[model samples]
Target: MHVPDGFINAPVSVAAGVVAAGAVAVSLRGARRELDEATAPLAGLVAAFIFAVQMLNFPVAAGTSGHLLGGALAAILVGPYTGVLCISVVLLMQGILFADGGLTALGVNITVMGVVTVVVAYALFRGLVKVLPRKRGSVTVASFAAALISVPAAACVFTAIYAIGGTTDVPVGKVLTAMVGVHVLIGIGEAVITMLTVGAVVAVRPDLVYGARGLAAPLKLRVGGELVDAPAARPVPVAARSPRAVWATGLVTALVLAGFVSFYASASPDGLEKVAADKGIDKNVEEHAAKDSPLADYGVKDITDARISGGLAGVIGVGVTVVAGTGIFWSVRRRRTTDAAPTHVPESV
Candidate 1:
């Protein structure tokens, strides 16, 4: 949920901003270990894909809709640290470019949506994968459960934050109940989307899916009625097993989803918006600072055709987000390489 400005007071919002800043800082360091030559670029595409899928909000209740939060999907595909960065990038883009989330409340949004979701989902996913059968299918199953749980977990976090700094005097219990209830329905959609996306990636390139790595059991061969461990398989050549194909396919899919499919997304308000309106949480909500931007509200300024305007905005968002995310991840990957490089010391002459 994109928390608009004025929903939280200045002091609490600033405190949340510090917390968000610290999280991003820690994740940046952790991401150094997660990013690699193949994954660094792939991570960018994942961010873009999440940005696109989030546009296709599905109906959750009579007046509430939900979209992919992308934390579990990202963590499963890449890693948790990188997943947090991915969501942060998407949230930053949406707030500044689309005027969807509040600039002032950016920290609150990141803490609740990016940090909390990624941490909770990834931790649960790891636990489930450990106990479940170590098969590809198990990863997908775990992804579904993790994603389903993450949504409500995020809702609870938001409720807690609101309880502390909510602008209105609404009953905290009521807010918690409504928020958790609607988000539970939303979580199912999140689970399905995460499961399908993770399954698809794991099928095509398990190596690219961080959670699926090391999941395949050693090959066994029957030798005169006795099963023995098979010889180790040779590593595939880098050229022969490139991630370009997967990257291109993912980018194309993202383009299709955001550029065209988003037109059919439910027009109803999302879970948070619905809850806020119902509970008077928006009584003090302020207008977005970027509301006048050309691409504000996911539409191009002065574009009469709704389809064309929205399509252009979506395409632009995908392009910008991919570029920005790739740059950040590639830099992180480079830093990791530098850190791992051997340093030489000259002998005393």
Candidate 2:
């Protein structure tokens, strides 16, 4: 959920800011290892895709809808560290460009929406992959389960944060109950989206899926009525299938989702808003910082037509987020280069 400015007190807000900053810093280093020519570009596309899918909010319960949080999806599609950055980038873009989330509460939003979700979801994902049957479908199953757990985990974290720094004096127990209960339903949507998306990607390019790496079981063959593992069979990465083609396809998919499909998103309150209203958590909700910007509220300034304004905003957001995400990931790839620089052995040798 995108926390508003006044929802949390200044001290707690700033503390969360520090926590968010530290998380980003750690992710930056860890992402370096995961970012390369093969994966760096995917990172940008993943962020843009998450931004797009988040626009298509599906109805969860009465008066409540939910959207892809993208922590599990991104972690499965890309890597966990990059997944954190991906969600963080989306949160930043939504706050600054769309005026959906507040600038002052950026840290709170990232902590709950990015860091917590990625950490919790990735952990569950890895655990499930280990215990479940090591098949392509298992990855989808793990992605679903992990994403399901992550949403409620994030809700619990928010309840705790509110308990400590909530501006209003709502009953913490009530808030917790409402938050967890509603988000559990929301989590199902998250799981389905995650599973379908991961399954689709794996079907096309399993290598692009970070969690699918090293999951290639030895090929089994029937030799003279005996079932035996083939000695020549080897893991084939999605990149080996066609790296450029995969990147192009991913970019196209991202654009389609953001440019056109997002326009028809359900216009209803999301899980957080519904819960907040029901539990009296909105009493201290503050305004967004960029609420008056030209593109504020996901509308282009000076555009009268709702479709055109929203479409342009969505397009601009996708373009800007992809560019910004690509920049971050490209820099990560470059760091990987510098970290493993070839030792000097000039022609003089």
Best by TM-score: 1
Error of 2 at 58 (Å): 1.2
RMSD (CA, angstroms), candidate 2: 2.2
Candidate 1 local lDDT, 206-240, one digit each (tens):
98999988888898999999999999999988778
In model 2, which range of ten residues has the least summed lDDT?
233-242
Candidate 2 off by > 4 Å = 221-229, 232-240, 345-349
Candidate 2 local Cα displacement, residue 76, angstroms: 0.9
In candidate 2, the residue pairs with backbone N, CA or C atoms under 3 Å apart (3 or more residues apart, or in different chains) clash, namely: 207-238
TM values, all candidates: 0.98, 0.94
lDDT of 2: 0.88
Tell me the lDDT of model 1 at 25: 96
lDDT of 2 by residue, 233-326 (tens): 5657655655677767777777777778878887788888887888777887777778888889888999999887887888888889889999
